[model samples]
Target chain A: MAYTVEGKGPSHIGIRMSNDAPPSHKEEARAQAEEALFGFWVFLMSDLIIFSMLFATYATMTHALAGGPGPKQLFDIHSAALETIALLLSSFTCGLATLYMRYDGSVKKTLLWFVVTLLLGAVFLSLELHDFIAMAAKGGVPSRSGWLSASWALIGTHGLHVTTGCIWLLIMFAQVAKFGLDPLVQTRFMRLALFWHFLDVVWIGIFSIVYLLGVIS
Target chain B: MSADPRRERRQELHGYIAGLCLALILSAIPFAAVMTGALPRAGIVWTIAIAALCQVMVHFRLFLHIDLSRSHRDDLQLILFSLLIVVLMVGGTLWVLGNQRAMMG
Candidate 1:
């Protein structure tokens, strides 16, 4: 009537002993485990909705370069190429992290994949910020040209999303450090993985529709 | 079961490759057309259309994860709904803003 796991060395590994405890305690834990994921999805949807408005604003002004250096002139496809490949690959890596979390149950493998996702994300953001700074050094401020303005609006907006996602990753990593891949943490990470990939998908849209097409002539 | 998810993903990466190729082909064709002066400036529509398709691939394969399955009905429905809203907003922006610009000129 009591229960225990095969090994109880780490608190991260646990088994219910509901034989003595009331059923409500078990039910409460189960509900908490599930709600984090749904709540995370809702937050992600809200984030995307904000991104949608930014998209509209940037799209409206993309064509309005004010005769200054325009998308075809200033936006470098090669740099964007590096950023794109890094991000797209990171997305795959992040998905891998979730798989490891869900199935592998090795905190080490999940950590390994997460580090990859983090590094690639870092590289992508650094490259992009470098692009922005390079533009700024050349006096390509947002006020100079509507196209450049929209470029900042669009790409910079995405840059913000990437930044926050990175922060979220760090938080999740911290939680894992605290709890390993416990069920509660696993569910939390599952949500992060979904949002992280969602960011990647949005970047693909920005790359092709906004960067690749709008920038490259 | 030590089925590495990366293995399956490796194959799926090909689909991303194909999507990129299609996007480039679509964009490059118009580029070649313009370079050769085969199409008028108004033929920019081709570029927009191809860009739209490229995004479609990203959504289906990467984000929403829709495939030929019964359970994916929810995903398909979500995508269709988003598509409708996207089309309305983007199409309306293009039309109204474009017309406003034309009128100003």
Candidate 2:
């Protein structure tokens, strides 16, 4: 009778030549990283569902003006465009931070990029709040009309996510300061990067369907 | 680390730079079109839709690091599945509401 060991077959070549060899520590760590990141991706997908629903509700309420200000009167396309630019720049910076973390492995470079990203995020939030304030001055509050209500709900939700991402960015910045770039910190950064990027994607929808179409149509 | 991490870093930087430039251009197109009123409303709608979609892909590929490669297969699958669910739920909601509105008139 012949029995086959897990790593003893001819098929087990190169790195798996030894039958009793356990997976390397680095390999185990890589697997763990993959699992953690993949788990975060799943969470992001769930968040996507929520945003999609908000968008759907907004679509239905687009013309439900109810004798109130509409998108054209409420939305300043120039300001919205600036907000979009801010968020997009922050997303790019966030990508740079992650890239520095992975390849450069330099804390200074990574933190620098993170700080830039945070500042841009703050700019975006400020601009968004300004837009809301101006809209409110023009009778665009949520209670005024179904369209305003839906718009506030949809945009506000995205704003809330961006706020959360900014907070997470601060927390991660402190973590990097305290723990340096350990695997745990790196994993957390990866998740934060994912969140930031996801927010940017949601903003694309907002700027397109909400701002662009709102103004044009 | 790879045999040469500097090269890898340079390549990664290039990806981000390219993504950023492409995204800026994509964003500018629709905004410019809308602002200039160079296109009909329907044409502007198409432009915005296309540009927004391309930018989203750029974000996924370069920023979020999700692509069609085998390494990203699982993440891509999750995204595609989530997209399917979003379309179903949102589409269904719109369809029902639109139908109701039409019937009421």
Candidate 3:
């Protein structure tokens, strides 16, 4: 079997030869990667649906402050801005890591970039936790009102995803150290890249719809 | 190492950098608009929401590499379909819940 690289992105398609021969190792690996990517894409889409529901719930409860502190009183633009930058930078670093893995195939360089990405992710999570704690201290906990509850649920769900993503990054680090850039390791890295980017996308929604609009309104 | 030529590899890396720059600019716009109050509150909200939508597309095309290019058509189709479902669910929820609140009042 013959393979042709046919794209400029992380998910490059491999064109298969028409000849009727048993699949070679390269062909099998490409097929497996493609299948894994497709499956992961499905998972990300389902995750998107879940986030949409959370946003919907948050929107409905935006005005249900129940005489408690509303968004304008609670959300600090500076902190939110800091959190946004951290996550966006992390997303960019994650992309760089994937590119290094695909183009240069340098495990050390990829791992370096992955570590940076992980650090940025950690910073984002820490800032988010601080924001939550500060809110809770001011009697802005989730149980305060429908508004606060929805706010916590929406932002908390995204934070939970970020936590899991950081754990996934740690696992990837271990895998890369042990297995190098084998096909399985490569496939896992690709999926994690997708997952990381998806979280950033969700954060975009949260910051724009939930925080920015909340402040404006 | 990829079989592609050195020039092609460099170009691919450039794509990622371009994406990063665009995403940063897009994110900064919304934040700036809100903080500076450069626009009215209503305008800022809409502008930020629209910018977020555009940034999502940028992430899809550049970061995740899901594009309209021939090789990635299937992934593109899946994304569009999923987007349709998201729109329906979000829009439906807002509509129903909003109407109920209005009636109750």
Candidate 4:
């Protein structure tokens, strides 16, 4: 019988060469991420427009006290603390997930971190909704006051973002599971990561300008 | 142990985590005061605003890597441009709308 080492043959030259190893995995991921980054920046700009409008609405009504709890009365630092920590921790974990993908190149580790990130996101959204529900229970509905109305608009917009993000996260998780870090899946994950982190940034601003500042005067 | 030169990205991530912790700590102190009524509401706002500035820097420099590297110079330009527009939109509305409310009252 002729000898064939299975992987070795003149016909297998293109199939097995391990020296230069064409653009490393890190390089490939970075290259693929470039387009995703550009797209995310565009998306961020569009989101900025939406946020600007919400800010305008809130600013228009900040001083309108119409028989409801004002910002200070409504914003509890303890609660905001929890909300902030949840989002911030999620941001860090998301970063870790990306780092794992970048460094470890272990899809399983990346997915694990992604799940942790999603859990943190869930906690943040839960707390925010709970806060909203509590307010409504206390008769701080949007119809009660201009302040409440603006609060509902601004906070509700942010809440809607979280809701959408959470749904999108589950979809991405499913895709990643089915595809196992295919380039397209990786690109999707990258874009989502940018958007997720961007939301945390916006929330930090929101926590500062709306809640923190509100409590002051 | 010292970090390897090849591990610059690791170092960057570590720095971001530390900066984030600092921002979190700074924000938390006034948070404590506000919840306990040890400080006024204005105190909460100012502290958080300052801390937010720190947090913003931390995100840009550490996480996003928007430093002055030649290749990244272009990214910095875009980031700053986006930031300027966002600030204008948010700040302009606050000024115009707040003043309108004051005038109406």
Best by DockQ: 2
Model 1, span B21-92: residue lDDT tens: 554454445445434656554565465456556655654564435665654454455556666666677678
Q: In candidate 2 chain A, where is summed lDDT lowest over 10 consecutive residues?
A: A10-19
Runs of candidate 1 exceeding 4 Å displacement: A1-39, B1-59, B62-64, B67-76
Q: Which runs of model 3 end up more than 4 angstroms from their true locations?
A: A1-28, B1-5
Query: What is every candidate's C-alpha DockQ against the true complex, given to 2 decimals?
Result: 0.19, 0.81, 0.73, 0.45
Write down the RMSD of candidate 2 (Cα, Å).
Answer: 7.3
The segments of candidate 4 whose C-alpha lies over 4 angstroms from its true place after superposition are A1-21, A24-32, B1-6, B36-44
Interface RMSD of each: 4.9, 0.9, 1.2, 2.4
TM-score for the second chain in candidate 4?
0.73
Q: What is the lDDT of residue A143 in candidate 3?
A: 94
lDDT of 4 by residue, B1-105 (tens): 123433755685686688568757856765666667765556656666677787777766655556787656656677778778878887887788678767886
lDDT of 1 by residue, A1-217 (tens): 1112233222222112112224554454444444444455556555666666667767777668777776665666668767866876777677667655654577898899989999999999999989888888777789998767777887887888789889988998888887667665666666677777777767766766675556434
Which should have the higher DockQ, number 2 or number 3? 2
Ranking by lDDT: 2, 3, 4, 1
Candidate rank order under DockQ: 2, 3, 4, 1
Q: Which lDDT value does model 3 have at B43?
A: 85
| RMSD values, in order shown | 7.1, 7.3, 5.6, 7.4
Tens digits of lDDT, candidate 2, A38-107: 9999999999999999999999888799988888898999998999899999988998888877765678
Provide the TM-score for each candidate, comma-separated. 0.73, 0.91, 0.90, 0.83
User: lDDT, candidate 3, residue A98?
Assistant: 79
